[model samples]
Target: MDVNALPAGPASPGHVLEVLRRGGPMTRQELQARVGLSRATMVERLDALGRLKLLRTVGHQASSGGRRAELLAADEVGRCAVVADIGVSHVTVAVADLTATVHATRRLSTRQDPDVVLQQVLSLGRELLAETGRANDFCAVAVGVPGQVDPTSGANTAPPTMPGWSGTWVHDTLAAQLDVPVLVENDANALAFGEHLADGAPSTTLLGVKVATGIGSGVVFGRRPYRGVTGSAGEIGHVKLASHQERCSCGRTGCLAAAASGRALIRRLRSSGARTLLDVVRQVEQGRPEAVALVTEAGHLLGGVLATVVSIINPQQVRLGGPIGALPEFVAAARAAVLDAAHPVALRGLREIAPARLGDSAALVGLAGLTADAVFAPAAVNALL
Candidate 1:
C-alpha cells in the first residue's frame, strides 16, 4: 500500500508500467522525473520492463537538445486480466489489459447458490479470454461482490442478497479454481474506483452512488477505496430514511435502501399495476402523473440520504450510477432535494452531479483495474521478469 516503496533492481518493470498508467506515453526524461530515478536507473527499468513485455517504446518525442527520445508505454495486450462484477441478478465479466481497455465482456444471470455463480464466473472469464485470443495472457482475476469484504482475507463477510456468501473465502476459492491470483471487493467500492479512474474527477476524495437493485455508496480518498474499520464505511443503504417503518433485507426498519432502491421502486410500481422499470419510464415519458410521482418520491428519499453524505464527505462531485440514477426525472428530483436539504457550505464549490460514464459496466471496469494492481504490483512484476 506504500506508494513510496519502489521495487529493487533493474527489473522493476511495474514502475515503468505505473508511470505510463498515470501519465500515458512519456519520454525517458519524463519517466525519470516522474519516477524519481537517475537516467541510468530509468533506462535499466525501461529495458527490463520491455524485456518482460510489460512496457515498450511505442513512439518518439521531439527534443530540443538531441534526437527525439523514445516514448514508453504499457504493452496492454501482453499482460491481461479478468474482471467480474457479481450483482444481485447477474454477473458481468470483462477481459482487460494493463491499460484497462476491455477487450471482451459477457454477462450471465445469477443463481442463489454462490458455488454455482462462481463456476459461471470462471466459465465466462475463460470464454472472454478465448474470444480475445489471449487465454493465457491473464495474470490475475478480480471480482466485485455486493457485500462487505475483508480486503486482507478477501472474504465476503455479509451480503444482503447472497445468503451463503458470507464468511466465504472467495479469493482463495477462485484463485485455486482458476490458478491465478484473485482479489475480491465490495461492488460499490469497485464502482467508485472505476469511476474515479475513468471520470477524470479532480478531487482525491470521491463518492460514488449506486442506485440499482439496491442503494449503496462508495468512498475513495487519497487514491484508494476507503473501507472503514469494519468494512462498512459506505453502507448508506442501511441508514434510516423513513419513519413509516419498512423492513430492510438486513432485518432493519426504515433503511434508505428499503425506501429508495430500484427493488423498492419496482415493488411500488408492481403494486400500482406497472410491470417493469421500463413501464414506469414509458408512463413517465407519456406524462403519467402516478409514474412521475413514484420516481420523484424515490429520488427525494435518495437525496435526503445523500444530503447527509455530502455534509460529511464534502466531495467535489457525486457520480450516480445504476438504472435509477440515470433516469432524468429521478436525477432532477434528487438534485432538488439535495439543494433544499443539504447545508450551503457542503454545496459550496460543488461540481455537477452526473450519471456514471461507464453505465452498467463500471464495476467490471473497476475489477479490471484491481486485477492490474494485483498482477503488476511492484513485487509481482519483479517476480514475473
Candidate 2:
C-alpha cells in the first residue's frame, strides 16, 4: 500500500487517468509537475493511456521554446457511464462520458414494485446506449434512489416512499442485469455531487437543496458527500416543522417535506383553484394576489427549514434544485427568508443562493461521476478487478 512502491512510468496508467480525471487535460510537462512524476515517466503514462484509447491527443500548445506540446484529453467514446435516478413518480436514465458529457437520456414512469422498476431501468438503459451507439463502451452504472443506502452493501435501508425497496441488493441486481459494476446512492446526495461536478463550485462545503415531490438536502464537505452513520445524513426533509399537523409520506406528522415541498405547493395551489404549477406561475406572473401569497408562503417555509440546515452545516454556498427550486419566484422568496433567518456568522461567508446550474439533470450527472469514480479510481477499480 506504500505510495512510492506502486508501479511507476507507463505501468501506472490508472494513476495518470486519475490525474486527468481531476485536473482535466494537460501536457506531459504539466502532468509531471502536478502528479509529481518525471518527464519520461509522464510520457510513458500518457503513451500507455493513448494506446488503451482512454486518452487522445486533442491539440497542441505553444511552449516557451522548441516544439509545441501535445495537449491530451479523455477519449470519451472509449468509455461511458450510466446513471439512473429512481424517484417516486418516474425513473430517469442518462449516459455520459468520462468527462461527464451526457450523450443520451430516457425517462419512464415508476412502478410501485421495485423489481419491475429496476427491470424497466435496465431496458431503458439499453435503449439509451443503443441510441447513443455506445453499448460496447459502457463501463459502469450508478443508481440514485430516494432513500438511505448502505454504501458497503448497496442495499436500501429505510426509504419511506419506496416501501418494498428496502433490503434490496441494488448493486448485485443491477450488476447482474447490466454485466457491469453498479453503485447505488441517495438521490439528494447524487444531486449535490452533480452540482459540484457541473458547476465547479469554489467552496469545498456545499449544500444542495432539492424541492420536488419531496424536500431533501445534500451535503458535500471537503469535495465528498458526507454520508453520516446509516447513510442518512442529509434527510432534512424529515425535519419536523413548527407545530404543523401535515402527515409526511413517512407517516410522520409535521415534516418539512409535507409542509413545503413541490407536492405541498401544488396541493395548496389546487385547493386554491389553480390547476397546475404552470397555472400557479402564470397567476403569480399576472399579479394574482392569492397565487403569489401561496408560493411566497411555501418559500418562506422552505427557507425556515434551510435556516436550521445553514446553522448546522454552515456551507459556503446553498444550491436549490428540483421542481420548486428551479422557479424564479420561489428562489427569490427563499433567498429573502434565508437572509432573514440564518445566523449572522453563517450568512457572513455565504457566497450566493442560486438555482442549480445542471437543472433537472443534476442527479444524472452525479451518477456519471459516481460511476466514473467506481470504474477509474485506483482503489475502487482494483476492487472491481
Candidate 3:
C-alpha cells in the first residue's frame, strides 16, 4: 500500500476509519448513514482507505431485504503502533493497531539510565513488529513516563523520583530514532485513560490514584484527561505531609512520596531485605503483620492527600492503582481515610472506590489508544499518508 497515494485534506476517510475502529465491522450503507456522506463520497473514501490498506472488507452482512452489504473493518495487519509504559522499576512495551488491539507485550526490569531503558523499549517494539511481519508499517510511538511530562516538549520537567529522566527529551529522541511521531504522557494519566476506556468507567468524572514506587494521581473529566497548564496538575506525590522527614528523590523533604510511597515503605522495611515494592507486596500477601501495618499506614497518608483532591475535582469514581493498590488492607485504610477527610458534599458525588481493573497493562493500553487517536485522526492521517 502506498500511503502517499491516499487522498489528503478529506474528512470522510478518517471518519470512516474511526467508525469502523470503534463500532467494529459495518456495512457500506450503515457507514454512509452514520457519516452522513453522500453514497458516492462514502464509496470514494472507503476505496481510498482500502487502497492504502487501512480498511478491509471482512465479510458480507446478512441481507435485510435484498442483497447482502459488504462488512468493512479496520485492517489490523496493515499498520501498528508502538507503546511504551516506563515505570520507576519496570517497563512494558507493546505493539497495537488502530483498532486498539494489542498484539504482543514484553515487560522488563527498568534501568536508571534513560538511554538503556529507551533502547530496550525500542528493541522490543521492533522485535514485535518483525515478529508480526509489519516491519516499517508502524505509524507512531507513544510513551508513558512516571513523572511530570511537559506536553509540548515531552520532557520530564519535574520528575520526583526518576532522577535520570530530568531534562530528557523523550518524544524527540523517540521520533528521531523511530522516524515517526511520538507522544509522551504521565504514567498515571495514561492509566486513567486506560481505566476509563477499558473498564467501562461510568462517570464523566474519574480519578486514578497510583501508589507505586512513587505516588501520583490522574484525573479524567468529561471523558478527557484534565492536564493542567504545565502538565503538572496531578503531581500529588509532591504534596507535603506534616510528619514526613525522609528526603525525596526530587531533593525535597516531607513530600507525600517521601512519607507514604511504596518506596518509602520498602525503605522502612529494608532490614527485612525487602529491596523492591514487589518484595513488600509479597510480604503483605503472606499476611506479614509488619508489612501490612506499613502499607496500611502509607494508604492512610495517600488517602489524606486524595481527600483534598476529591474536594477539588469532585470525581465520581476514585480508582486505586499500581502495586500498592493491590492489597486489600491498603485500600481499606485508604478508603477509610478518604471517607473521614473528604467533605460531606464531595462524598455524595463519589461512588465507587475500587482497584484498577486493567492492572499493569493500563498505561500501555492507554498510550496505544492515544497514539491511534492522534495519528489516525482525519487531518493527521491525511498529512502522514
Candidate 4:
C-alpha cells in the first residue's frame, strides 16, 4: 500500500477503526468487505492507523486455502476514558478502554457540595488511571450525575436531590481539573447507554428507569439518548401525583419520587435502621411485611409514570435498574401497572419489563462508552492520524 497513491477527499481511517472497535478484531479482507473500499485503499488506511499507534494486529484469522489474514483491532490501550457515576449517596470512578473494558475502579461516599464531589471524581479518576498504568492515556472524562443537566452548557439545573448542585458549571470544572474534554450526563441516561452498549449495541429503542434515592428515566432512540429540548426529558422524579401528598425534595407537594423512591421507602422505614437501599431489598427478599408493602407501592407509582412514558415513546425494551428497581417484586408490580395503564397500541411493540442487566455499574459503563464515542468520532480519528 502506497501512501502517495491514496486519494485526497474520501479516504477514512476512522471507518476502519470504528468497525474494529464495534465488531472486535477483523481480517483485512473482512475490513475491506465491510467498508466496501478497494484492497489498496483499505491497506493504506490500516497502515496509517498502525503508524499512529491507534490500531494493532491481535491475531490471524483462518483462511480457506491461502495465507491467513491478520486480525486487526483498535489499540484501546493507546486511548481510554475516566468515568464517574455520581449517585446521590456514592461516587464510582473508573478507567475504561475505548471498548468499554473497565481497567480499574473505586467507590466513595458522595459529598454534598458540588465542588467537593467534582474534586472527589477527579482525584479518584487520576488514582485509577495511575493504578491501571494509563496515567496519560485517557482522552476524556465522563460523569453521570443524579440530576438534570443543561444540554448545551452542561450545567446542573434545579437538581432536587443534589443540594448545592443546581447551576453548577460541572463540565467546565471537570474539564479544567483533568485538562481534557468532559461529558456530564444524567445518571439514568448513562444507565440506558450502558444497557445499550452491553446488549451488543442493539438497534431498537430502550427505556431504563433508575429507582434509587430518586426516580428518573433514560430513553434511547435511534442510537442516541433522547435528552429533549431542555435536557430534562427523563426527570420522572418530579412527576406530580394527585393521590400522594408527601413533600418532595423539589419543594413540591405530591411528586411521585417523594412517594415511591428508595429514599422514600427508607424514610418510611427509618425506624428499622436500614441505612442503604440494599438493606431494604434484603428485607423484601426475606418477605418482611413492611418492606414488601412499601416496595410494591413504590413500584406501582413508578409504573404510573412508565405507562405514560411507554404510551408516548413505545420503546422496545424497558429496563428497571438501581438498588430498588432490580427487585423482582417491584418489577412485577411495575409491569402489571404498565400493562394495565398503557394503551393497547403502545403495548403491541413492548417487550417484557426486566431488571437492568448491568446492575449498579450501568452508569459507569455508559459514561465510559459515551466518552469513547466522543473521542473516537471521525474528526478525532483524523486528528490523531
State residue 158's C-alpha deviation in candidate 3, in Å.
5.6
Our model 4 lands, by Cα RMSD against the true structure, at 2.7
Candidate 2 TM-score, C-alpha based: 0.87
Measured with C-alpha atoms, the lDDT of residue 90 in candidate 4 is 84
Off by over 4 Å in 2: 1-12, 38-44, 74-77, 266-291, 381-385
CA-lDDT, candidates in order: 0.76, 0.77, 0.80, 0.83
RMSD (Å) of each candidate, 1 decimal:
3.7, 3.6, 3.1, 2.7
Better of 3 and 4 by lDDT: 4
lDDT (Cα, 0-100) at 47 in candidate 4: 84
Question: In candidate 2, what are the lDDT values of residues 128-176, reduced to their tens digit?
Answer: 8899999989888888888788666667764566577677676677877
| Model 1 score (lDDT) | 0.76
Off by over 4 Å in 3: 1-12, 19-25, 58-64, 76-78, 133-137, 158-160, 201-203
1 or 2, greater by TM-score: 1
lDDT, model 4, position 239: 88
Q: Which portions of model 1 show Cα errors greater than 4 Å?
A: 1-17, 33-38, 63-66, 201-204, 273-288, 383-385
The candidate that achieves the highest TM-score relative to the unseen native structure:
4
**What's the residue-level lDDT of 186 in candidate 2?**
89
Candidate with best lDDT:
4
